[model samples]
Target: MNDKPLSGRKAQAARNDKLILEAAREVFVADPEAPIAEVAKLAGVGISALYRRYPSKEDLLRKLCGDGLARYTELVREALESEGDLWGAFREFLRKVVVADTPSITVRLAGTFTPTSDMFEAAVAADELNRALLARVKDAGVLREDVENGDLALVTESVSSISLGDAERTRELRLRALELYLEALRAPGAGPLPSSAPSEEEMGARWVPKQAK
Candidate 1:
C-alpha cells in the first residue's frame, strides 16, 4: 500500500467540485436549457469530471436549485434581522431574490420538482423562515390581520420571480404587489390613521434602480 495520506488529494478534489458547481450554476441561470457539454466547458472541467460529480442533467439542476434556495434563505434571514420594519425587511428580501442570478433557479424549479429530498428540505427551510418572519410582523401589528401565513407565502413566491427586468422595474412590481397585499390586510380604515402615506419620492428612493448606462 502507498504510504502517502490522501488528505491533500481529497481537499483538492473538494475545491474542484466547488468550482465546477459554481460554474454550472452560472450557466444554468444564463440558460436553463443549455447542454451539459456547454456547462462542463463553462465550469472549466471536462465532461468526464462533470459526469463524475453529477451523473445527469436533472441531478445537476436539482443541486443548483437546492444551493440557490439555501443562499436565498440566508439573505431572507439577514434582511429580517437587519430591518426593523416588516415591510422593509420583506422588500429587501424580494430585492435580493430578484437581483441574484443564482437565486433564479428557485423560481425556475418552483412547482415543478418535489423538494422532499435532503437538499430540497434544507431549501424549504427558507420558506418556513419567511412564514415565521411574516407571523412576527403580523403580531407586531405592522402587517394587517387578514393576511394569513399562506397568503404571505404566496406573495413571497410571486415576488421572487420578478427577475426578467431591471432592478427599477422589478422594485416597482414589488411595491405594487406589496401595496395590494397591505390593502387586502387593512380593515376598511380601522387601523391607525396614516398622517401621510408613502410619498412618490420615498417609494422611488426605496427602490434603487439598476446602474444605467
Candidate 2:
C-alpha cells in the first residue's frame, strides 16, 4: 500500500455538510413550508444525500431548530457577559432571537412531536439558562417586579414569531415593541420615555398579545 494517508475527504465532507446546513437555514427561514427537495436544491446536494443526512423534513427541522437555539443561548451568554447594562443586554438578546433565521421551529416541533431521545434535555437546559439570565435581570431591577415568568416566556415566543415575518418590518416592529416593554418595566416616575418610541401600528404588530385577564 502507498505510504501516503487517505486524502482529507472526510474533512471536506464535514465542510460540505456545514455549507448545506447554512443553505438549509436560509431556505427554512424564507419558506418554513418549503419541501425538502427545495432545501436540497438550495444546498446544492442531491436528494439522496439529503435524505441520508436527514431522514425526514421534521428531522431536518429539528436539527435546524436545535442549531438556532444553541446559537441563541450562546448569544445570550455573551450579551450578559459583555454588556453591563442589564436591560440593554436583555433587549439585545431578544433582537438576536427575533432576527434569527430559525425562530419558532423549536416551539412548533415541541408542541407537535415528541423527541425520540435525550435531545429534549438540551432544550430543558437552555430554558434553565434563560431563566437564570432573566433572574439576573430581575435582580438588577431592569425587569418589573410584577413581570411574571410566564410574561418573559410569552415575550420570547412573540418576538420570535414577529421576527419570522418580513425582515425589514420585523426589525422596525421589534425595536418598537422592546421600547414599549422597557417603558413598562421602568421604575415609577422615571423621566420622559425615549423619544424614539414606536408608533401604535408598529407596537401592535410587534407586541405579543397579552393573555386574557
Which candidate has the top score in TM-score?
Answer: 2
Model 2: residue 123 alpha-carbon error in angstroms: 1.7
Q: Note the residue pairs that clash in candidate 2.
A: none
Off by over 4 Å in 2: 1-8, 29-33, 80-83, 107-113, 163-169, 187-213
Q: Identify the leading candidate in terms of lDDT.
A: 2
RMSD of candidate 2 to the truth, in angstroms, is 8.7
Write one digit per residue (lDDT tens) for candidate 1, span 5-83. 5598787778778878888776766676678888878767789988988898878877777777677778878866865
Clashes of each: 0, 0
lDDT of 2 by residue, 1-213 (tens): 777754698666676678678877777766766787988888787888788778888788667767866787787677667557887787777767766633455444333323434555765666667667767887887775555444555565665566536768877887677567657665442554344433334422322222311
Off by over 4 Å in 1: 1-15, 80-83, 101-103, 110-116, 148-213
